[model samples]
Target chain A: MISRHGTPEHLPVRPFVALVALAVSVATFLWAGTAFAQASAAWPRVSPITIVINQSPWFGGFSKVVEAYEKETGNKVTLDVNPFAGSGEKQRNSVRSKEGQFDILVMNSAWLAEFYHGGFLTPLNTIDPAFKLDPQVMSYDDTGYWDAARKSNNAKTGVVYGVPINGNIQVLYYRADLYEKAGLKVPQTWEELAANAKALNSPPNVYGMVQRGARSASDISYDWMPYLHSHNGAIFKDEKAGDFTVTINSPEARQALDVYVNLAKTVGPPNPGSYGQAQVIQALLTGKAAHATPVIAAWPQLDDATKSAVVGKVNVAVLPHGPGGRTTPTLGHFIGGIPNNIPKDRQVAALAFLRWFQSYDAQVKYAQTGQPPIRSDVYAAAFMKTPEYRWSPAVLASLPNAKMMYTVPEGPQIASVLELRLNQAVLGEKTTADALNTAAAEIHDLMQKAGYKTARLPPLK
Target chain B: MRGTADRASAKAADRWRFYTLAPALAVYLLLALLPIVNLATMSVHDIHWQQGAARWTLVGMKHYAELPRDVLVRAGLANTALFALIAVTAEMLIGFALALFVSRIAVGRVLYRTIFLLPILLPGIVIGAIWKLMYNPDFGVINQLLHLLGLPGFDWLGSGSLAFLSVIIVDVWHWTPFVFLLLLAGLETLPQDIHEAAMLDGASAWQELRDVTIPMMVPILVMTLAFRLIVSFKVFDEVYLLTGGGPGTATEVLSFTIYRRFFTEDRMGYGSAISVIALFLLTLVIVLFMGMARRRMHAH
Candidate 1:
């Protein structure tokens, strides 16, 4: 079997195989080096992150924003939108199971404390090492947002839990035409509001004021907080207490309740107690109600010129003041935070997306699409110069006087308690004094049950 | 000696049969009994919801003890019971009458039957949304109709009593078709000669229905009633979508409470305890009704 060239045929094949093997090894090394070089050029391997949000109109254009983000960064993004009323429950369950299904939570500011208390939220600092919020994004109108939005860690250390994506406040939405027709100025006080409502009130045609008095507790109570605040009533005595005293059963609160009930019973919808935001929005847009309150984020749809009959007639103003002074609206800002248990990669992506979303440019885009901007600079930005959003100026003017609801570990739960009692008053099931007193008792019991060191103080004056 | 061998072989065959069923029994135990066992275990512990199955602090009988004291749980139970009792009775009576009328019709009987079954076929959530819109205060079709007739429109889901009644009416609307279809099937199978003979004997319509139809249809009636009871006890969707246990706990039922306690409150231990009790009660009621039915059938 020897070849004429002087070596065996099989012996020559061994050297040829060795040469091919050497070439393959060299090529593999070069290919790997090229891949590493490209990777070093940009952080390329960002896994998909899922964000859980409620189905609010403010989030209407979010899918497009997400698609844009995904296209720019080659990373997949998932949105898990739940109905607003049920989003809290879904988020709480996500917290309980510590599932990595949701990397980010776009939730109510009222819910931040509970999620933080339960160790469901990741500290904003932990989500990124090189994170710096625009100073404008940090506060507005001298509102120090770190304390405004809890400055604490799950281990009870110094940390920020969430960033405010929306600086939402309640505004009184009124039919300017109706006020003109009735020869009434925009009511500035509770007495004036009541009188105006009584004057314009007509059954089955144009009832006076509309109120959300439904019994879901949080929804109904959030709107009613401004009324109590305008009357100088506080739901709790202190925010930092382990167990706070309930001081809601004040003469001021009773008076607020009396006004609320009288408005609802005399001039409001036939079943005012059944009214939620949906009903209120319908009433306001159709010009069925002469006035409405706490018309939050809903102004977009209610004032859409093509969609609404009252487009040119609706005006925004401060909620009616009380004897205490001008009314202070309650804050239920939409806040965004990462959950504690998602992958590190997702944590980075979520933080990047959040910062990009709340950027001044993004805020302009959001403002143009009817989303309220969280930053003060967004107001001074060129977008705010033009009035695409009719409600922006009023929102900015109201910003200085806006106040955060109690940021306790059980704020929403306690909010519901306030809601139920206020609702009972609105429904005439309990006298104002009795309703507030009962709510105070229940609030005390709830605080005690949560293992708080509790006390109950009498209402101020 | 031969007979003894045969007997031993028969016993061995029986053992083989049971062995053949072992794989199915094992799967059933894993899929069904394991959750029940897990629920019982959870009910005993103070569950750290975040660390759910991985960790727990043992606190026996605490949740069970609290069940009786919880006002919401009691109200939910009462509402569920009242909903089942009233809804089932009305559905059965109306379903029976409709079934009889349709069974006797000589023209367009198929169309009538199809129309009656439409509500039952629709998704509960869709039905709920439709009802909620119809119950709206300002622009609901019902209110519009009333206004046209120069009558005042009532706030249907606004008042406590009215909210409860409206939810009941919706449930009845959704499920009465189920009763109608089941009873109609039974009516179709009934022999016609019996009715003809009753007529020839000069027995009035009422007499024929009371004496002959009642006795013959008892089994179907009982079975339909039993099915309706089981289904009604589990009502959640309509109540949830329509009233959400509001204007204030007016329509909150056991199932809705279970969801709220577990998911909303994150009280897994307490919620599981309630779930265990609910499962047991529902099972007992179904079994009791079925057992009585079986006994009555055998006696007949």
Candidate 2:
């Protein structure tokens, strides 16, 4: 098609440009195809398989175990790790939206109800019996799984939905140096704790105590649940009736809020409403406060040089008693479950990986890293015998009595209301009674809107 | 014969020009007009999310009936109107002054013009984030400067009243440049002979400006005001990131309210209703503005 020399030269350039464009397009298409093929291949295969963990400590120890398992079995094992923070709700929501994205989800027990109800997770009972009996397999402790946590994991039809991965119970953290300076012992009751807090108040440099006052799902709800339970407050009465009728408007709940708000006002910093889990930890770590009630999972941060200022001076104990005369810690734990959409072969591989991770050896390794083990035997193992972790066993022993947050479909919404009302009371915008009454009314209205029946009061025992 | 055919065709075209506009009208109806009609229909319904299913039922003007009684909704509407009035007025005044100054400049005029348009070039989100850091209570430059001046630091985004002002300030900073650029272009294209003639007659600068320049700039000014009003009415990003509609819903604008209903509350029907009401209100305001401009133009 060449005519003039100039036109011929121009024609070559055009073809060259076209050739480059075609090559680029082909390369891109092949690249995309290969990526898709690689992604599909990464999906769990039937034989000895791979399990991806999107959690913390479990991924740490489980990764090594998976490698060993594959080496011994002569089958390839792949594990992917995803770390998250704050509440685990976002992670749970992710799995619910994208099934098969995770072969096994490492999630908090609090989310089990939502997961099971939404059909996002598979029940462990359906796994192959051989892998189910694998002692190395991580499974929920039949005895150690407390009533609240168990009830949370129980499907409406009474089927177990998840295997407990680790246990977490709330504890009171205090600075021993400050307690000594104030000539106070560890507070045993809420009244005593308040007294100690007031005594330890030193002004702009330091405060007596700090807790999570921030308005968020986890920050406000975590510490409040124990207080509600200690004072015998019930979020709801009848599950079948869907009655989310009663709230923390009872005398006990009010007393708890009153005590909590009063202490937060007098001893808390200028902006108590902005404080959350990390801030509470910072209060104790930087010696800004003498005490805080945080989950046991955060205790490890106290010893990390980068995070804590009072490494050796910090100590942990069960939460103080309320009017009930019994200390009740809130139980929080992570559990593992297979996705129902995962291929059957991959499910077997996930079960195999879980069995190894839950073995006594692996659990002990996890305990040594400062996470509480779910197994009864692991609590008395070599890890707990160490001086650094001697108190962890005591914390673990208290897990049996710990209470979980309410697990109804409306649980999150009710918790949001409580958080908002509690924040108002703490900020002195409303009295404890006033806040509770308003919250109770709002919660009752929400329950009615959800079509739940009103619960009748039970006769006294 | 061809010339006669062409003349006849041209005459017939004049009679059927309306048909030529039909496709555009059809597209607008399908995309914009129809969705608005659908939104108005959906607004009066209750909707909830259960097991990934959205259930909706007609509640009739119940949401609207409740609107007057809902204190937060009322406060939000009042705040939005107040924000639009104050913020748009300030932006227009400041923008006009900048455009006038830059238009009179000689040396480095192009450079100054580019610099004047720089704020408009940056994204809204970036502007909001930069302003948020500036207003931070603890280590922000604003507080640091206040401390340097031996004055007590103030919570810019933390205080309810100040948070609203802070968002307005950021809006003016980002969007005034847009108005300035528009006005500057209008200023450049204005007829100079009228101003020169007035100056020759010993007319005072204020008199000449009030009587000549401003009158000529009417159409451009109206266009700028209309554009800014529409944008300011949908203020979302800055307020959302800055205050999150909080320190107790002080900065909760209508857009933020609609977003919360749609995403957080999962009440799509209620959200759709709010959107419909907002759309209707916006349309009414625009029409009123156009009428006023038309009247002013006719009077001139």
DockQ of each: 0.28, 0.09
Instruction: Kindly give the number of clashing pairs for every candidate.
Output: 0, 4
TM-score of chain A of each: 0.82, 0.77
Docking class of 1: acceptable
What is the fnat of candidate 2? Answer: 0.02
Model 2 misplacement above 4 A: A1-114, A127-157, A164-170, A216-223, A237-243, A276-286, A294-301, A307-313, A328-398, A455-461, B1-75, B107-133, B173-220, B269-271, B287-300
Q: Name the DockQ score for candidate 2.
A: 0.09
Q: Among all windows of ten consecutive residues in candidate 2 chain A, which has the lowest summed lDDT?
A: A141-150
lDDT tens digits, residue span A1-461, model 1? 88887678877677897999999999999997776666444435466788888887667756666776665456678889888757777777676664657888877766666665556767677667666566677342222223323433222334555666666778888888888887889788978988888888876777789888887636678777788878887777665543366777877777777777888888898868888877787788778888888545777777688768887788778788889666788876777878877778888878877867767766766666676777778877766666456577778777777766776656655775776678777877788888888888778877786666666656423
Output DockQ, candidate 1. Answer: 0.28
